[model samples]
Target: MEQESASGLSGRAGNAEPVAQTPTPDGAQIHEDYLARARRGSIWQMLAIALSLAIAAFSIYVLGRAVSAVSLSALRQAIAATSAEQIASAALLTVWSFLALTGYDGLALRQLNARVRYKTTALASFTSYAISFTLGFPLITAGTVRYWIYSQAGLTASKVASLTVIAGVTFWFGMAFVLGAGLAFHASAISAINHFYPLINALIGVSVLGAILAYLVWVTIRHRHISIKGFQLELPGLGLSLGQIALGVIDQCAAAGVLYVLLPSHAELDFFTFAATYVFACILGVLSNAPGGIGVFEAAMLKAVPVASEEALLASLVLFRVIYYLVPFLFALAFLGAHEGFHRWTSLREAMRGSEEEKVLEDEINPLRRWYRDNWRLRR
Candidate 1:
């Protein structure tokens, strides 16, 4: 038995090859690095959120001091005092603002060399912004909506992402351009914010404009795509960037005009001054990320428009949300519902047509079967 076993082992050793094991250790090391980086990113996000919350809290406290306590009746009186023309003008501006929003996607598509119909782009832009402005998060709301809409229009995921980034940058560029113009022109506009000297606002505005200018210069000179991490960024041409700036200006102006119209003319608030304050307040609200920037936005708006009484301003703010944010959100929901209903109706009609065709084909090929079905099934 021992001799037989020895012979078998010797044959096996001579003929057998070394078995190769999968290199799991190297893969494990790579996975560990990915996890580490993800954790670090999460930590940074948490820190940023915390910071935003702190700022929001401080702003809320300051705003509390600026206004006397208001009651429901007082708010109603303020609303009652607002004129019909003011309401209509504000609504009209809100409509124009949303229309300008569609241009963000339009201009972005041009930059990306992506061909999509203006109608599709308008739907995507309108619905996405309508949802995101209220939901208070772009990634979850607008980004997902864009992905869904753009994908059906033949845009790949990366293209959609690029489109989103470009469109977002366009809004900021416009905001910066307008804000810079507003502050540079009117230094004392929103001094209540940060208690800073008027010169600081002007300087900040210049810095924002300078940053946008620098971006344009870089795009003009390099004329090359930038790669960061694994994503490729194709910057728009100088002329296109200028167009983006124009879109932003129009959107911001319409948005600010929404409130400007709502305010009492006696408030003595001019467009440029209100635009500066509105832009500043908007930035604060965006940074806070509280849903609709609820308290933070109102506070900033109230603080910036010191001429308007707290109760009257509160009424305007309420109307602004209803017209600008809430009305559009409802309309978006209605549009989505109608779209889904239409698709469902189409599917059902197609299914019925398909069944009729199959039935006719079956009857044509098998008269005996059809007769049996007609007699037996009908009798049963």
Candidate 2:
């Protein structure tokens, strides 16, 4: 490669292509493959960001209309009606949910051929999800947080990118798993979509499950990486795939339960029934990229549970948001502050240690000079 570069620039200066280049399978220069893929990914990411913003705006506008019709006094009464046991139960479920989320980063690290201490992985995972869950752009919010933590720990930007992609796939696997089971087992549970056609809902559930199975079987058979644009999904060993699915299932269910537990006691909703609506609403929220899926999630939830009184239902939604979205967001900010403080303290300590070592060396080699320097500083 150096020989060709020199030959092309041999005693001349011009915008000349390299006289020699390695041809790729598609006949483009080998370097072009990387460039092409990067460009493709960048374009797609920009388009997605634009679409998410639009959806969020539209959702918020629609939600404003729905909210205007509800009685504020009744909503307040409904919130007051909630029991301490329910709030405690819901918050405990949130802890379990975040614990499962930590596993996502660990599994992604395994898939991306990287490793970090469990504590570091937990910090990154929790901070990212806590922020991104409210902020709505995981790529920007969660991806940046992961890069900051993982890069400092020695992983490169490219590997962190792959890790984020894998973590996201893990989420999908769980969502699909839960959705399929709920739909297949109890198509009538989801009040939002069941009214359209129960049979169709079950069929959709089957298709979702079938697709997940197909992916696992295909990867096992092919035994090759799946690459698209600039990203590659490394085919994990069968055990890792199963573990990812489990993590997703647990994480998704626990998160759903956080909101589910807040519903009025008399509401005719079972876990499976509420979870199906919850998952679907959560999907809409994610796709909208609305902050905390605020307007979008409430709209979907209210639409699904029309049987419930609006005032009581609205209060439950408000409490659910406080528990699942707002609280974690504030806590994540606190964690970030503490992390920064510790990092700064460590840096200061290391700097002081280096200075002390230098002073000690001077005193050993030239005691008089060291003494004078210290006395001068003290005098100053």
Candidate 3:
């Protein structure tokens, strides 16, 4: 009967012959566009996964060959020979690198106009990178962690996604800047790895820098925004863009310094030259999608950075992994666990308090209800 009445009322209101609802022309076109985009995205994702697997497999092969010649006793002695001062320097650089990492998320939030607290942004950035660096598949691990924290701070999925994209751009910008400058200034040194003419390497560096200059000029002239699948993302202005690059450079340099300081005193490579090699290895490691770029980075570093004592270099790499990657990863896990527990306890307490207040209100209302009922009976 209710359904019939509702149908009759709707029909009377229309006062015309009923017509079946169909999607509008624009709506249908939009749906088709979305489907096409999804199909393309899936294809790209598959290709990326296949590429990562290939890189990882090749890296593992390279690593196996490299380590076969290494002597365990020599490696142990090399590690023991590392001075307390070198360890202290590397540890300090690691701390500095992570501090710069926190700026990535903080700057990203500013770009999004999302007014989250610095501590909150720091927590998200540090924890996400720490977990993702050790776990592999940053888009999954880092994005998940960022979303988990940012969601509670009033950021939507789209906003968090945009923030992640912006932060990634910051990192790449810094990398390109570092690589460009290093290659331009010391192309001869880099030629040892690439076997290219110094002039050619310098040209490549100049080209990269030129591209960055072009982008800066373009943004300065007008506001730039990207529209991907109907979502609009505003680009940071020239000043903020510069800041992003600076922060990236600082972070990458600090990270590279950690490994550089740990290397044996006999290695004797310049900081700028070593930084270029470090960035290159790090990039390949990232592409391989292996946890902490395990085999890939070590393999690349071994191949690029020529040292007399491979065992000593390997020892330094091991210490770098422990201080820069493993320690932070463990710390982040414990911190995340504690944060989750505290949040749950706080929520439970709030819920109990709300329930208690409701119960108290009900207790006070019961007496008034009885009084009103008795008065009503007398009046009747």
Candidate 4:
């Protein structure tokens, strides 16, 4: 009987099904491919970071060498020679530039169909640009600032990101337009600084302008959307696109004007020519990935603009840094701090008010509780 029971148990166990331990060939291959792609993405990211670092380091070295040529005493003399009128003009232009920057956010808000107030849009735009301008990585810094402010206004994370991207596009449109116009009209002037032939510069300028025109026509015809990593971005219509181009040009020109006013009166460079040089220098500085384009911008300016007074040029660059980059950065920091403090205070006040109301209710309920207790005791 024991032998028969053991055999029956063995047969039952054998009939029970078991799942396979190994994955199918196709499944295994898919997983391996996914891992390979991930590895490649990581490698590419590392390479990009390394390249940025290298460019920044090299630009800094160049800046250091350029500064060594000008004497501190001469620089001081040059700065002292600058008229109060010029300083005032530069300051005014700085304000104008920042104002135009606010329009970038405003336009982005319109594109997103987010009905945030004008004040909120200005705050988000100005603070983000101020912070990002001084910090090197605009994408991260600007996006964070926008998200922080816009989230309170009910903007989703993706919407904030789209806003940031749209704002960036506005800036590029302005930059490309100015650069192209300057190059096309005054290629000879630019060629003197960049060493490119006039014909080539003109061709490049024409190509850029053509591209912008084509984009404008395309958007005018119908709605256009671009998909990036599963995120869909709708392009603005013709009117909005025109507004972007205008704002961009104004902003870029104003920013460039800040430096232009600081240049020596004897520099002999016209506004259009100087603007192109300034834009080119800015592009190089941006590419270097240094904070505020610090070392790179100064180096490029020194190389491109032919100033008779090197000391004056150096002094102008120094003042430009202070007026444009440093002042805004400090102001943004203070504003952010004050904004956070005020928000906290408001929240605390509301919380305290709620707690007081709760205490008053509890106090009123205490008398009723005592009355009920007495009645129940008497009845018992």
Candidate 5:
């Protein structure tokens, strides 16, 4: 009977299945595959970052060379010839113009339903303009920086991008209006330049058409039936579009005036003629991709103003830079400093709040109490 019982137990043990183990090789293979994918992704990301840095470095080097080649003596001569009163007036006007530029950002933000404070918006606008002027690449210029700042204001990336695009359109539309109106009314000026360089008009026309086509494509893509975060299409209507166009005219007129004021007193160029030349020169400068359009702007201005002597034209360009670029640059720097300081204070305040919360928890726990101490020790 005992032998039969023992036999039955051994049979039961034998019938029970073995516990399954995960295959080490399969686990290792999956880990290796994940590691390989990560390595490949990292390599590509590094390569892209390296390439971008290299391109930026090369561009800066080239711009530096161009700036060094400019005649400082001529620039100084121009500066000396400019009247102090005129310089002050030009400076004031330049500041006012830049303030108007802040409206571009305001309008864009309003469209995006991101109503930032006036001070914050002004800082963003000025800093962006300053960076764009200094960097010369609009993509890398102020827009990226503005996006960062605006993002901190609780805006999503897509909203910031849309605002950026709108602001860009505002700027370009103003430029185009200035260019078009200048060409239309100052046909004589256009005729003179076109007679000399027929290709200029063609190039301008092509650029304008290309911009329009690009905008249409962008709008079409955006207006397609798609939703992001429960939000449908959020584009400005025809009324806002017209308002943008009008703003552009106003902005460009002010910008062109900066150059016009710097010209020699005897220069036989009316506002329309000046605007035509200014727009062409500015377009050429932007195309050159030179920092602040430094050498490019000077050269183009020299070419456009045939009535003025080369020296006089060079002088005018220098004065224009001082009024429109340098002074604004200083103000932008001040604004950036203040902005950073405010952010630092806000961060400190957040840290203090976190510390206060920690203190409150400490007070509630009352670590000095025997039970609390015993509980804390148990937890540890």
Candidate 6:
């Protein structure tokens, strides 16, 4: 009876399956299901991308038609009437204004203690701006490009992303300064204009204020031991934050001046009014996301500056694009193309050298193999 009991226990123990072990067939089926879901997700993403591209193309076509309908004769006359000196000044200012944009990146880098060469910073900055100009989505391509370039300098992806975010904050801070100053100094001028959407102005004010408050809260939370990955920026004290705001105001003032210089000399608009109108127009253009805000920007300017004729507005907008968007865009393209060309050439040269080395090794190996075979036959 005891032997029988022991034998029964042993048999049961031997037949028992391990608790933690999963069956291979079941695991494989689960994996196959996951793969199917992933494929479906990939298809959805592709469809979304296709849809977005189609919409963007359609918007561009519609905008192009609006531009083409503007009187060419008036455009030419406005172009001719623009003083050579004013145009030259505007061009110079546009270049300098963009150069100043690099300062925002530099400041952020300094804050993050990520030391990089000036040339690298400039290239990253310019390439980012250029991509933003052409692609209409600044953050996507610009961030990717920055990661590619800055990663080589020992900066992690998170740190680069942090710097980019900080740079954007500073830019908006500057914009607020321009808007606030324009509002304060030209109260009468702003009140005189009829805006299609008064709510937009209110919204702009609220957004800026909300942003500042949010930044403050973020700083407080971070100070209490919450850490943000890749960005080691401390909440700059109130004074420092104010100083950044001041810098922003200066930047936008310079930007607005570039457009102001291109406007007709006879247009009875004060600096403050021009600044206010320009700010509104810029906001509209940015929201439209037209490539470099091309058609959208012109349309916004026309709407904002109601005193100016459509022809005059169109002419000024075109000239502004020429100075600010088109020229810088072309230069940035050339710079990127040259950089890429050099990298490609170097890669090709290395590939050729690798092929030559492989051929030499093959040549030596073939002779050795033949010699070994002949010796083996003799020995046999």
Q: Which stretches of candidate 4 lie over 4 Å from their true place?
A: 1-58, 360-380
lDDT of 3 by residue, 1-380 (tens): 99999999998988977688986679889999999999999999999999989888888887788789888888899999999999999989988998998999988898888899888888899999999889988888999999999998899999999999899899899898888888888899999887989999899889988898998999899999999779899999999999999999999999999999898853557889889888889888988878879999998888888788889889999999999999999999998898899889999999999999987787587988767777999999
As a whole number from 0 to 100, the lDDT of residue 235 in candidate 5 is 58
Per-residue lDDT over 1-380 for candidate 6, one digit per residue giving the tens place of the 0 to 100 score? 89999999999999999789665678889999999999999999888677655545654665566567777887799788888988998988777777777777787787678799988898888778767766677778778878877886689988898778877777778776566555555655565574424455545556666676676666645452224554355645454466567666666777888888877753578876777677766665566555666666665566456544566666777788777777878888788788778778989999999999997787687988767777999999
The residue pairs found clashing in candidate 6 are 174-248
In model 2, the worst 10-residue window by lDDT is 188-197
Estimate the TM-score of every prediction: 0.83, 0.82, 0.83, 0.84, 0.68, 0.66
Name the regions of candidate 5 deviating beyond 4 angstroms: 1-75, 196-234, 364-380
Judged by whole-model lDDT over C-alpha atoms, candidate 3 comes out at 0.90
C-alpha lDDT score of every prediction, in listed order: 0.86, 0.83, 0.90, 0.89, 0.72, 0.72
Q: What is the lDDT of residue 248 in candidate 6?
A: 68
Which stretches of model 3 miss by more than 4 angstroms? Answer: 1-54, 367-380
**Per-residue error (Å), model 5, residue 68:** 13
Q: Is candidate 4 or candidate 5 better by TM-score?
A: 4
Model 5 — TM-score against the truth? Answer: 0.68
List, residue by residue over 176-245, the lDDT tens digit for candidate 2.
8888888877786663555857778889889988988887787777566878675766677667788989
Which pairs of residues clash in candidate 4, taking residues 3 or more apart in a chain or in different chains?
Answer: none
* Candidate 4 C-alpha lDDT tens digits along 1-380: 89999999999899988976886679889999999999999999889788768777877787788778889999999999988998999999999999999999998888888899998888888889999999968999999998998998899999999998899999999989999999999999999989999999999999999999999999999999999899999989999999999999999999999999988863477899888888877887777777778888888888888888778889999999989988988898888888789888999999999999987787687988767777999999
For model 1, residues 269-318, the per-residue Cα lDDT tens digits are 66887887788788888888887777888888776676546888889888
Residue clash pairs of candidate 5: 174-248
The alpha-carbon lDDT assigned to residue 378 of candidate 6 equals 100
Work out candidate 6's RMSD over C-alphas: 12.4
| lDDT comparing candidate 4 with the true structure | 0.89
